[model samples]
Structures are given as structure tokens and as C-alpha cells.
Target: MGKNLLFIALIILSGCKGISQEEKKEDKDTKEIAYAVSKTDAEWRAELTDMEYYVLRKAATENAFTSDLLDNKEKGTYVCAACATPLFRSENKFKSGTGWPSFDKEIEGNVAYDVDYKIGYPRTEEHCATCGGHLGHVFNDGPRETTGKRHCINGVALDFIPDSK
Candidate 1:
């Protein structure tokens, strides 16, 4: 009975993987998790630009102040570049001076959350619910007048849609 129990414990432990959200390159043996709009890695690479693929699929951060949409003040919506899932509204966007597009809130139910320790500290990682594309991280230091949650997003992971005139 003792040997049997030891074998069972070893089997269980062997099947478990670290929960940290590492880049796909680090764990090429694992399968991608399912999402509402899943696609093959080749399809994603063919669809997105190099930068977009890095930010959305590989979970990389873009350089600060490098996004064209950082200063966008027009009324519109921001959708996931990978899957076109609405993620944030223009009204929620604010100039946090973080050099990337910042928002106080997300379009409810359109975003998903996961905890990642890729930076040596646990941070709330956000993704597009439809395609599971990495959007960015959320912080607590935000305007107290509104949601008080600062969603620091990667501009390359999102596309803007101006309100129809």
C-alpha cells in the first residue's frame, strides 16, 4: 500500500506544471489553452504583424511612448488587434503618462484576467476574452473619481475604431 501511494503521488506531481504565465518559447511543449476565437499559431503569425504577435501572443511589453494611439483623444472604441473583441471605450481612456494607452475600465465581460509572475512579481494580466490575446496589466493607482483601476495596455495589442459620424 505504501508503494502504491507513492506511485500515485508521483504521477500527480508529474502532471502538474508551474502556473506562471511564461512566454510560449519557454514552454514549447505545452498546448495553448482554449479560447472562444482560437487559431493556429501559424494563422496568428500570418494575421498579425511582428510587433502585434509579440505583444498579443508571446506576452511581451512594447517600448514606452512608442504607440501611435497613446495620445488619441477621439471618441471611439478599442478592440483587440488579434480578434476584434471590444475591450475598452474611448471615454474610459486617460493620459496616465505611462507612454502606453491607459484606461480606467474595460468593457465588462470582454476581457479576461490572469495572474502572471513573469516580471518576478505577481501582476494582474489582462487578455481578450475572445481570443486570449495578452492586452496588458492593471494597477491600483488610478483616478479616484472613477473606477480607480488603471489598465495599462499595449497599444499594439489594440486597434481603435472611431465612432461613426
Candidate 2:
């Protein structure tokens, strides 16, 4: 009887441990950190379209091959749509066949990364450093000639600025 009670207590404690860990993670994710550009949730929603708000603020993904920028080949810099911070340069862009704007590298210091487990596995999620807007993910499969990193960015998260002749 004592052993049975101890076993049940142990099981309950382990379940509580998992819940506490999940709560800690939620708290960490919700803690606000100061960025170069910060806005209230209402302001962000008012400024961005529904899709943009979903992808940038809520970390939702757009459908592959649905971005207007997927086929863009013009020379320019890609800036964060939320904060207009320069992210990837045209020279770093490449055809990754992933239906998203792929860059071998980002303009230094403009992007930040965090681990995302939304899909049941860990992925490196990139975002604009200035406004903390979700941009996309980074993968290791990329051109060997450069950084060997594929920065797969969301079109709705970026705005292209054509280079002057």
C-alpha cells in the first residue's frame, strides 16, 4: 500500500514538472524585450495587413509559392516590412526552389534567431532585430560558395528597394 501511494505521488510530481516547464517557456516567450522599434499590439495590427500581422506578429507562415516576391530578380536590398531595416542584399539572393525568397546571408546584425518547435521539431526561426518581427527560418542546405546558410524569408515580411543605376 505504501509503495502504491509512493508510485502515484511520483507520477503526479512528474506530470506537474512537465506543466511547470511549459509554463516557464510560455513566460519566457511572453516577456517583452526592448527593440529598436517597439509598438503596442493594437498599433501593429492597425499598421499591418491581416496577413502581415499574422506572419510578422503571430509567427504564422504563408503558403509556399504564394509570395509575389518569389520570382523577383531585380537588383535591390530587401528590408523588413515591419521596420524597414535592411536585411538581405540582392547579391545574396538565390534560387533555392523552396518557393520563398532565399538568401545566402543577411546584412550583418539585422536579423536574430530563436529555436521554434511549432512543427514538433526544432528549427531556427529568424526575425528582424529592430522590431522582433518574424521573417522566416534558416536552414543549412545552401550554396557552398557563400555562407552555406539558407535564409528562407517570407515575402510579406519584406519590402524590396530597387538599386539605383
Candidate 3:
């Protein structure tokens, strides 16, 4: 019966090790990141609407073709809804027909990026550099004459400021 008891001990030990590793990974993922426009969860909730909170803080995507900015042709700057940081210019905007607003490029130094595997594959996730709010994704399918990069942004994440004439 000694062999049986040893096997049981090994199984328990292996299980515990697995749990410890999992916990470490979880902790790493949820670790706090301080941003230039840092705020508590309660503060963010108080300031943002439900949809804004979901899209900016929780990194949720809005439905395609639902953004009022999709057909916007006015000259202006698109800023981050959460922080008002200028993200995209009207000059860089294009009708990508991808439902969401597309930009050929972002206001350089205002956007940040990271890799996320939430969909089981790698995608470049963009964020507002000032507040760390989720903006959207950048893809390679864009005008080759320009940046050749498609900044497929969620409309909910942006606020348009029409240029004063």
C-alpha cells in the first residue's frame, strides 16, 4: 500500500503546483497599471456611461456600423472619449467599409499598442497612451500610398471635435 500512498501524494503535489502557477499568471494579468489620467474604478464609473465604461475600461468592442462618426466627413480631430487625447485626424480618416471608423494613422505618440490573444489569435490592441483606455486595433489592410496601416477604431472610444471655421 506504500506505492499507492506515494502515488496519491505525487498527484496532490502536482495539482498544487499547477494551481500555484495559474494563480501567478492571473495575478500578473490583473496587476494595476498607473496611467497619466489614473482614476479609481468608482471614479471611472461615475464619469463614463455604461457603454463608455465597458468599451474604455473593460476593453469591450462596440457593434459595427453603429457609430455616428462612421459617416463623418467634417474636418476635425478625433479624441479619446475617456481622456480627450487626440487620437486620429479627420484628414487621416477613410471610409474603410469595415463598419467601424478607420484611420490611415493615429496622432503619433498619442496611441499605444499591445498584443492580446483574447480571440485565440494575436491582434494588435490600441489604447490611449494618456489614460490607458482601449481604442481599437490596427491592421495591415489600408491605403498603400499612405501608411499602409488600417487603424480600425471603435467609434465609442472616440469623440470628434469639428474644427472651428
Estimate, for each residue in 6-105, the C-alpha lDDT of model 1 and write its tens digit.
9999999888885544454332125456788989889999999999999999999999999999999999999999989989999999999889899999
TM-score of each: 0.81, 0.82, 0.81
Angstrom error at residue 65, model 1? 0.4
- RMSD in angstroms, all models? 8.8, 4.8, 6.5
For model 3, what is the alpha-carbon lDDT of residue 132? 91
What are the Cα lDDT values of the candidates?
Answer: 0.91, 0.90, 0.89
lDDT string for model 3 (1-165, tens) is 999999999999877754325422222147666689999889999999888899998989999999999999999999999999999999999989999999999999999888766775568889999999998889999999999999999999999999983
Best by lDDT: 1
Off by over 4 Å in 2: 1-28
Candidate 1 ranges beyond 4 A from true positions: 1-32
Displacement of the residue 5 alpha carbon in candidate 1, Å: 44
Residue 131, candidate 1: C-alpha displacement in angstroms: 0.2
Residue 33 in model 1: shift from native, Å?
Answer: 3.3
Report the lDDT of model 1 for residue 54. 93
- Cα error of candidate 1 at position 100, Å: 0.7
